[model samples]
Target: MTYTQTTPDHDAGTPGDVGDVVRLLEPDGSRLADAELDPWIADLSPHELRALHRDMVLTRRLDAEGVALQRQGQLALWAPCRGQEAVQIGTAHALAPGDFVFPSYREHGVLLARGARPEGFMLAWRGEEHSGYDHTTINAAPPQIIIGAQTLHATGWAMGAQRDGSDDVAVAYFGDGATSQGDVNEAMVFASTFRAPVVFVCSNNQWAISEPVTVQTKYPLAGRAPGFGIPSLRIDGNDVLACVAAMRWALDRARRGDGPAFLEAVTYRMGPHTTSDDPTRYRTDDEVERWARRDPIARFEAYLCAEGVLDDSALAEVAAAADALAAEVRAACIGATTRAPETVFDHVYAESHAPLAQQRAEYVEYLAGFAAEEAR
Candidate 1:
């Protein structure tokens, strides 16, 4: 299961070690023989495969539109997940509706997979809302931007689920960079200690901002979980079938009250960290070009086509669906409106607090002063 690269820069060690990475699809668009992982997706029919492809395409389309909106100054920032669609969409689709998902800011694909509205999803990026949607409605949390803090949130939720004697699992999605944060480690400790029904999914997209993953840890990111008494899986994030199988396996473990599971989805972020980043200052074109060849959507499409599940009309239909989604999301983002400044004070506390109340009054008075002065 060794993969050969034309470039010498592509190392053949742990990163490319097929033994450690669960891959069901090769970069060449052929199915890799993975007997252990095959049964997880064996029940998938041709229609289901087509649906997965559609989901990936639409996720990419939404992500592309988000980037464009950022570039056009409609959004304050956009975290592009261009090359990681398979990991997000595939994993997300494996979840039960009652399960909860905590995602980092870049999980546009996951949010879409969970059936969150495009307009609502755009609201956060547009700087119009603190969160994109009502989290409870989707059984998910708003995108967490505070590094690895969401891990703690997911862990806490899982603990509560454990106490309630429910089967729902909580999943936390973060990047390789977040692994360096103390909050992530603490969350892992709590998750393992309580035997919480949680899954920590680390999307190891090589670089965290400007630093490579090697800078964060000497060992494989998945290797860190075992020390906490949690089992881990290192999987090819670009392979849709692999992602789906891995997530199902992890979720099954969590539902069985087997403590926590850690999954490192090894993929690459094709675009900048966000619209504000300039990747050119650090990474090379050759590296980007190499990863592009393993694009998840392209690989999945090839697999479907080869399997006789996808044809010219099917491809056309998916493309049209993506185009329609992009258009709808674009319109929604453009039409999104901001709330009044006073509304910010509304959700600051569950009960009336004197200090916040005083500040709200002062803020109103301060705004009124401008109106009074304008009368002059």
Candidate 2:
């Protein structure tokens, strides 16, 4: 992953690169180094690079800061997407205004890039009962914590979009482990048979709770997509340029009425799967250090420096800006508004099922009884 190392020569397939995992940027920080993707970079301007930097930096800061809040008990739980910012943000950027995105809980970067209010995510983790803002406002569905359920939801959304006379697309993000789930397979079948306008983005970050990605799929995850009749692609998930381009292509295909596509982003989960899990038992520090060498931030910064799009002073300023953002999130977390004590009863049911109603009443009465004792 060192900058001096020559770009890895991949033939679009490696130990399991089933979907033609294209590489536009080198793990060591070279861009357009993938001759196949050179045109995309040549077309990108310096300002675009700056915007990319901002998105990636802010996302990473939020992820790290959110994890800290979890450790401090400000949040009940947080799934850190610490090292996967480039793929998340890049893909989000590729989405159009009418597109819908269904995300797994770890996609904070995608939501942020799609203009999701930070409060929506924060309040959820703070133990709030609902999304702070309506998801449709950002062309996104509410975050789903269940492993692979969002795939079906996304497919259904795409079907609706198709019936409504619009060509807008839907992108569903899931992990390597999700590919094996029946819901995900059924989603693929639905999308393929109906030619739904959807893109299934699988971020194969090499771990499912504690299982390696290899265990999820015998072949490269991307290859599984084509088997379902969806043209699939695999790309260096850490390479910002490649991720953006891959997503762009997928979106274009969907909008053009070409049907759904699947993308397997080959990256790594650099931190614990969640605040509760420990990676040390399953992975070695040396392995982590090796991946760190291919840090997306470091890789892009080096590319920017090489391309004269950013200098040390500029990077220092960005880092400083990121630090301030982190501080702000930390401060905001300390004062995160609590859910109203009565909220637990408010949305328990639509028409009010008798069983649930009884339970809610009992719980409220119990709380009231405790309060009366305190008053006495």
Query: What local distance difference test score does each model get?
Result: 0.87, 0.81
Which lDDT tens digits does candidate 2 get at residues 178-243? Answer: 887999999999999999999999988888988876565555666666667788767878888988
Candidate 1 segments whose C-alpha is farther than 4 A from its true place: 1-20, 350-355, 370-376
Residue by residue across 114-187, what tens digits does model 1's lDDT show? 98988867888888887868888998899998999999999999999999999999999999999999999999
CA lDDT for candidate 2: 0.81
Candidate closest to the true structure, highest TM-score: 1
Off by over 4 Å in 2: 1-20, 33-42, 345-360, 369-376
Positional deviation of residue 355's Cα in model 1 after best superposition, in angstroms: 4.1
